[model samples]
Target: MQAEAGNRSGLTLSVPMDLRQLRYFVAVAEELHFGRAAKRLSITQPPLSFNIRQLEASLGMELLRRTTREVALTEAGKVIYREALKLLALARDAEEQARRAANGEAGAVHIGFVGSSFLTRLASDIRGFAAARPEVEVVLYELSSYEQIDALQRGQIDIGIVHPRVMPSGIASRVMHREAFACLLPETHTLARQEAIDLQQLRHDDFVLFPRDFSPGYYDKILSLCLEAGFTPHIRHKVRNMLTIATLVSHEFGVSLVPASLGKVRLPNLVCRPIAHAANPSDLRGIWRQDEAQPAVLALLECLAASPA
Candidate 1:
């Protein structure tokens, strides 16, 4: 092989030196005895000596001072031995990382989720996934159901936690949890003190709700539930975040219909009550593109399936 002289170190190196030669050189350099080094490498002395000579020729330098009685490393041999150790270690690490990534035990996954999911078991599910797959990094993004659908289609997120509904083209969904709807009312509201309130009782009440564009399916579902009781809500304000809707209701600006699990949000002056009439349950679903086959995404899906949410 042709060798190139390095400008900085005045060392010549073959363009592609065989790693086996370097290994043999390191063995002999450390042992300082050809017989002992060959035994350590499970080889005979002749082949070991040949490999060391080849390595020295490839680097265009004398790597060893050999005598009938003993062997010792030259200055060039010491430098090459230290560098070979590092190269071998790096090669081993690279192979291990590749294997772990192929098996879905390492790498990063970008996840999108609607805000309300945080109030449910989603947090615990994520925590469990992180604990089980310490090498796999989880990146979180808070997005609306509609936003998640678009992000999934664009390949911006690997997975999404959203309210279950008809998914857009190329996307598939798995239901994670089913939750009932509840009314969020101001503490000073007349019906707030009641154990449970009928949806019809709030017929004339002004409503605070999430913006229709953010999640049209969920927004319309809430409206339909109100209509089933008596009257269509008088929408006074629309916000993009569920928690903010609760904050608005706390100030008595209006009431909102949110997933029952959001009742866990303990805002002062805010109260949540179950609707007396039977209502459609809200579904939390995990969504991904039908064509997605990323190992990280698959591992996260497995985690979600194993955990209750």
Candidate 2:
């Protein structure tokens, strides 16, 4: 302690403590053992003891009751220990807030989508989102509608573009577009001459279809349409994705049912014809974990909703 002399009187003055000393003192106070506190701080026992002594001397108070048999905190030490924890937490929070502001939209976002997402209008939607929010870094992963739902709940993905048939129980969805079913045929096929062909007529012919597990809704939709036409689909070959199915149809593997978006693809030996039996087309929707007040995700949803079907 230092004595400050004034014209009126003399008063004892104590040094103002720094954060490092408070941290060291708190660690030792909590552990109640020099060796353990040193281990916790990844420092040697000698340095830990020296730091604690310096902290006590600076505070002008004995913070810990030390003995050969035991170590414990004095009453004053307990008060400082509790306050130090809160101070450390607040300090960390402030640092994080500053970093977040400096980095702008620096957090990572996980994006999940249907298999044909990259090939369809979803590509344009993604490009538009990237243009608008270039600072938001996104990690894109291709997933089925069901898998997308699971990922969202598990906090695996932040956004999803999926088919409408999949129920999004805890998530929010925005209708991006509906991809109408189209008939894929060989250029020389009779149905290619017509503007559209009845889905029923093709039920008798061998067809290429997506695997049931990969796209249960899409697979079942086709099967149900065939059944409504008074026949079971003659699914001769099963493929994993739209491109593969389109390739097989181009090689005259069989006639296939596909989304109108597939028409964008130019296959030398194949033509895409609209299905006359389609009453209401399948919907392509954007799914996201619901946020009552997330401006960024809301902006993305608005973009998707305004896009063409």
Candidate 3:
């Protein structure tokens, strides 16, 4: 999502109570005595016992076996305690990332992009961003717009460059541009001569498509556009990377529909023609978690906006 300065920072970061409960249970399980563990945690025996019971209830698995004389961990409890420790460590790391993001000191921003997009002027801007913001590490993923959206939802990536579609509820997007569609044809193709090509004329042609996972919305958008022109696109092959797709198109494997920006590819045997009556072409957008407020995200947005294409 594109970030703009809003005076209101309504983000409230919370770790689950089950996590705290797990920690308490682990402390007790490790010591095998509530009194000793309570001493370590600076809490009383009764409360420690209560917290352990609550943890068991939340997890729906018995973690500890306790009696007046002795204490031991149940089989499930032992396994859960090990996993719980890992979860707590991860939770702590996430908290640190959030704090760094708030302070604008250090943080990581994961970015996902479609393959062909990397050849655009935006690619140069990204390199410049990396050089400019050395403290903010940007992890790049070559994914389709659809995969990018899924990654954003799962918190796998902080930002995604994608095409418009049915976005998840808690995700927000900022429209970058409604780029026109370009028809990628082989230099020797019969229809490659004209200044523009009517999409309807390509009805019987074989096509190359981006992987649906990478560009669900955009993928379907292309298909739908062809359908609207009274032809169902004959998808002969699907590839994840646009450059590879273009390379195949250059070899005349099949014609493909791509963003106008793909003209930057400049492959030797590939020619691009504007699509005639191709419905509003794909709109590239930046998407991210609605609850995420990170300076690195804002910084990237600023860089993108300031960049010249």
Candidate 4:
């Protein structure tokens, strides 16, 4: 719509030409016959002819030459016709991009996850979502449950796959996975042959546990469970990552309790046995901000909901 003066006809920035007019001109120019163009546009010839006349007046030039038996494009008409096609194509692309963005088919989503989530069905869910929405950019980060909560509140991540905790105000959550805590032991340990081991039976064994600072709430929950069983666990080693804790237990460093889902994996030198009469642990889940529900994030949440817990 910017101004370019005195080059061609009376066409100027102030003339206020519209897409409909450009479409009409292109149709007439391509067909080189007003009757055919009017039929194609699903309009009567009189109105089509009038619109063309108005277009030519605005441009201050004769765009089409009409004889009793034929019609043809003038030199000025040829130039404008080529540029009009490009403009119309760009306009269509602009509309399509806007629509795709609104529908959540194109954009980026940031997800933060705890390491333990990968051992469960969460990995498959992430893969499925990425495959289904190729246009959506998926960004991932590994963080602790506490770290994820901080990231969500500070607007650093859109969603968090984390351990259960007390959600702060303005946060939303859904339990995407749940599993009872199982006793992790060395494959060669005496308890490995048993279907289940009593929690009190391990009172003399050292424990590999997460540090209280990793998640004070979860740490306290584990302690409360052990205390209920009539004993205080002697923590021999503390680790931050769940996978490392499993590895440590596999190497015969100490005994530990873990999610039952981890028992699905047949790790070398490791055996997961249920703790008889043990209380259920808090569930692993997905969390996000309630006030800022972006479409891309919602689409990912749907994928998580459909995944096996």
Candidate 5:
């Protein structure tokens, strides 16, 4: 590329100019005095003068008209000065953008989550994050806890909101919210009218639950809670989706023990009642790979920490 003067002084300056030389030229052009420009640039006047001479030689044009009395810019010098200012400004902007991305203040984060987490304050938390870091884009994926674990392991997602029984190897997690289990029962069921029902009361009822493989830790916790209530549940229906379980219960398929968040579904024929004797609360955790170093991921974690569910 070349910068050519419009008038037929016929000057065409090639674009192999160094940024440092351009900076020096701009300082001199703006100051109109080599000594003052060198002072402003915190450099010795002799080196500045040599660099300017070299820049003029490379451009094959005399950019400055200099005398003992004063300094002035030639037409080509004036044009070059304006272009140099733009180039320097662009370079500074690029540097600042890179730094912001490195600091986690700007970029993109892929977030994986289970659908039930939305029942808590996950939506509000996401909004808060967006408001806090408007430059960082957040993309969300809805996956089961197990799928999230797999995605995290494969580096497909930056972070996950999951219900993990045990922290997987090389993955780190923190519980963001803890919720007690609730019973989703058909409105016509005997215990549906109770504000809170003991699990023992539903021993004879067929249970609709998430498949054990979906989240063994949570599934086992539900079974243990039932055992503590004095009877083993008769699991007759298995599901993978929390909302589907509620839909099934609404149809009188069976009762289900699910995180209290499912109460928000509020299906027509289903009522979610608290478990009277359940002591363990299902944990919703924020998980990430231990080796993650992305600035956007760190920024998201910070946002998650500031907003409590």
Candidate 6:
């Protein structure tokens, strides 16, 4: 058996009045005169009267008691007038929200980034974006390249600033060449005095490097650079973050290779020197799901483009 709408929903609902009719009704109810309401609505009195009568007929009630001299709302009309005002306000709010979303001036963008990205201009660029776009919220998450990939594939984040490589197929990306490679060492290390050192020079040193599982391509790139220098490194520790590696190096745990940008960071006891053989590599790549190229994401990308890598 067919069920009544109110019974099915477990809540009584009034007639589904359209916004135009409700707007006309509210204007007349507030002004209490057909001539003033028509002027406010930029229409003539005849159509306004017709819509008010139609609304009354649909609801099966006398909304207004009128004569040639003045118009006044009946008791039932006063109640619906308040409710109609509320409904009209909600409709206007919905339209404004929709327009803002389409223009990319509202909504939120969730971003996932590796820790090392903060060492470059990209960090300041992001801060600039937040400042300029006050309406679009920016949600940030610190994650490894692996975690960023998982989040991207699962639709957990809107953008991922990754390292070493871009995400897999079906994802979009922008390569941002952020930094050149550098060797990290304790300030007292024998080779620390030189501003530039060849990769082969540190083949014998124990290495503190980012873990392979955290970023496989980056891990392999370091290894291949070592092989090109003609020796395998003696890895002393595998860590997840650049700061941790710097902390370990400061304690004289081992010599390490990191981005030259890291030298700009305040690691009290650590030092950085350019790797002679380490050519420029894009330290960060912005990745996101192709399907999720939303306005907020695009706005962020536009801001990212202005900052120097």
> What lDDT score belongs to each candidate, Candidate 1 first?
0.85, 0.75, 0.78, 0.84, 0.87, 0.82
**Per-residue lDDT of model 6, residues 1-309, tens digit only:** 111123222554467686788899999998999999999999999999999999899777798999988888887787778778777777889899888878777889899999888888888888887887788898999998888888989888888888866457988887764677788999989999997888898878999997777787778778888898999989879999888999999999998878788888677778888888676453688887887758888878777865666
TM-scores of the models, in the given order?
0.83, 0.62, 0.61, 0.87, 0.87, 0.84
- TM-score, candidate 3, is 0.61
Best-performing candidate as measured by lDDT: 5
Q: Using lDDT, rank the candidates from best to worst.
A: 5, 1, 4, 6, 3, 2
What are the per-residue Cα lDDT tens digits for candidate 5 across 93-117? Answer: 9899999899887988899998888
lDDT-better candidate, 3 vs 4: 4
Off by over 4 Å in 5: 1-17, 35-51, 57-60
Q: After superposition, how far is residue 136 of candidate 2 from its true place, in Å?
A: 1.1
Comparing candidate 4 with candidate 6, which one achieves the higher lDDT?
4
> Model 5 lDDT vs. the true structure?
0.87
**Between candidates 1 and 6, the lDDT winner:** 1
As a whole number from 0 to 100, the lDDT of residue 226 in candidate 4 is 84
In candidate 5 the C-alpha lDDT for residue 216 amounts to 88
Poorest 10 consecutive residues by lDDT, candidate 2 = 1-10
Quality of model 4 by C-alpha lDDT: 0.84
**Model 2: lDDT of residue 13:** 33
Residue 239 local lDDT, model 4? 95
Per-model root-mean-square deviation over C-alphas: 3.4, 14.3, 16.3, 3.2, 3.0, 4.5
